[model samples]
Target: MSEKVSLLTARIIDNRRVAPAHFLMTVRLPLSFATPFPGQFVMIRNDECDGPLLARPLSVYGFQRQQDHAVMDLLYRVVGQGTSLFSRMIPGEELCFFGPLGKGFSIPTGVKKVLLVAGGVGVAPLIFLLHKRLLPADGKGIMETIFYLGARTAELLTGLERLCGFCDLKICTDDGSRGYHGPVTGLLKHDIGGFDAGDTVIYACGPKPMVRAMGNLLQDAPFHCQVSLEERMACGLGACLGCAVAVRTGEGKTDYRRVCQDGPVFDLRDIVFASPAGP
Candidate 1:
């Protein structure tokens, strides 16, 4: 929550389908809105429509400041009623939004290598972290950056074109229709040994099963790792107490933290994953 949260109305600049069921919506905000950091999210809802009463949480896919305004991109899949309403939205439509809420990723000081792992639409924030914060103008940075992306098939993968110009990109598919056969984690497991663990850090986001598998896979690894958790939220603020997650505290005690406020991003080791796999 380093950035101040504000409730404002943004006009839709563009909203179009990027993949089969995924859509990328671009909105224009006033210059007074606070800039968002990578991994931060916004709660957005179309006030004029008869959709779900509560606003849905969406990750900030991209953001850029213009001379008089700021443009933001939100990438989402059409999964249910609320999103269906959003898909029908046209340009010039106004949407109510509250954000850049929750804690975001913090790159470790002097880290020599960075790894980003994403599944499905989760690539949104990771792509933002790469271009907006990680890569330099010369297309090189002090740290060696690599991105590992995975999806059910090639068609479901988003942000591949944008990622190629920024870092080393590795892709995988579950159906063997893309770069590597099997899960994206399989690729990471194969290449992880090449890096110095002490100088490396990993950031990830995806479905619950994928995230759980990632945690279990890297539990004993020496590299520092952080993950963004996807959870249902009511109030983007901490007031509702609906997005609480169990976590291991420093004292070895279990405690509850609100995902909406305490984090959307947290140390992978601190999270208590109840299931062996799956949500």
Candidate 2:
């Protein structure tokens, strides 16, 4: 069946702003909601009369199951007219959304260290990964997960305090208000030395510039890096051809791949960034 078959109306259980422009919405999905992997996203649209002509695609942050009800959480920022409309939605409102879409992060055996990188709202998928992997209810976590979260300012760093218990957390603010000033990459540089490159892997989700930097830094290193890309997508599937990512080939060639299908997550070395952040 088409992935869209997973489509169902999600009833809002709660929706509130976490920061000046960031919002978190808790919603209950139908029993048939597809199980989504870390790094996957959903296309959503609320029941509105006008504007926001198309659905806005968002990352699947986290989910829980209570009795027979399944609850999913969405973390979003008000950046445009579409997201602005999303912020206005309140509890008890229903929004049409579906997911478990796109390719997600992967872990091979013998990985002892998992490094996660997030900037701004990039915390969404990484948080889900922490729960479903490192902090699973069974408490059988094998790998040590570390997070390096960054934002422009302290006020822009979302959910830093609440997620500290899940993993080794490090915070960076560009304007020197948080744990470290400058880039999160600086923190990684300071800490990456402690990890064995061969046994370490990286997962990053953030702006193009940040993801691109990661690709450049670890491309030739022993670390296996996977990056979750952010794109403005029309359809949550490949049918729209709206979200294309540049991929690098062995023969000095670049291939355009669809982010909604080929991946929201991909091997860092495979990406050909527009402006290469060379190491």
Candidate 3:
């Protein structure tokens, strides 16, 4: 985790609808603001509004530094009151935010292949990761990158333009309106045999069902898998115990971990998914 978490204000530069019910908001940040890693997020709220008391946790979609200030893009879906308000915000309006919070995805050494999986708006952080990996500051050799994207419908899929010409992009839509006619996980499962698990790493961010299904698919596999969880967070800091997840301890016991502070990212094998309740 980054040691510096600052409470700052950003001026909205653009807020445009990208997909149906999805908006891509661009904001300008202070030049001194620390850059956030992939899977890390920010807590934001309308500075002028008094409603929606708590700040909403949003993943960093895209980031770039300019001469005088930095720019960040936040990709969000209008699901409730907070995001509904965000959709109506215009340029020059300021938003209060605090973060670069939660742990992010870490790639291990000697990995030859990288697989990025995303579902719906969960593609936000994965896009950030893709940008960094494609244009790394360290000038390291690029790995074989493959991206699997899934959405409920073709209209709801965003970021396709940015993803093209960058990696091996595969897409799936639930309604057969896109590339594959099934879930993104199913696409990955079908193509996963091409790579050797020992030197491959998988990073995923999506809804619970998609993630859970991925977990089950790779539970006994040798590939290194990490998942970014989208849990409800009241406070970005550890003080609020709102985002807790269950994991297996070394002794095979179930223990709880905080998603806000400890991770939005975790080893896929470490998570313990609860069974669906009986009717």
Q: Could you report the Cα RMSD, in angstroms, for every candidate shown? A: 2.1, 2.9, 2.4
lDDT of 2 by residue, 1-279 (tens): 125447778888998898879999888987678777878888888755487877888888888777898888889999999889888888888888777688877777888888989988998898888777666676545788888999989888886754777778889988999889978887777777688987888888888778867766675567888888888788877898888778876787787888988888888888877734431
The TM-score obtained by model 3 is 0.95
Q: List candidate 1 segments past 4 Å from native.
A: 275-279
Clashing residue pairs found in predicted model 1? none
lDDT of candidate 3?
A: 0.89
What CA RMSD would candidate 1 show?
Answer: 2.1
Model 3 CA lDDT for position 124: 92
lDDT for position 152 in model 2? 88
TM-score, each model? 0.96, 0.92, 0.95
Per-residue C-alpha lDDT of model 1 across residues 1-279, encoded as one tens digit per residue: 456887999899999999998999999998888889899999999999876998999999999999999999999998888888998899999999988999988998879889999999999989988887788878786678899999999999999778986888999999989999988888898998888888899999888888888888888887798898888889989999888788898898778788888989989898898834422
What is candidate 3's lDDT per residue for 1-279, written digit by digit as tens? 577887999899999999989999999998788889889999999979987988999999988999999999999999999999999999999999887898988889998888999999999989899887644655443888888999999999999977887778899999989899989999988988887998999999999999999988897678899999988888989888888888877898877788988899999998989934311
**Runs off by more than 4 Å, candidate 2:** 1-5, 138-140, 250-252, 275-279
Estimate every model's Cα lDDT from 0 to 1: 0.89, 0.81, 0.89
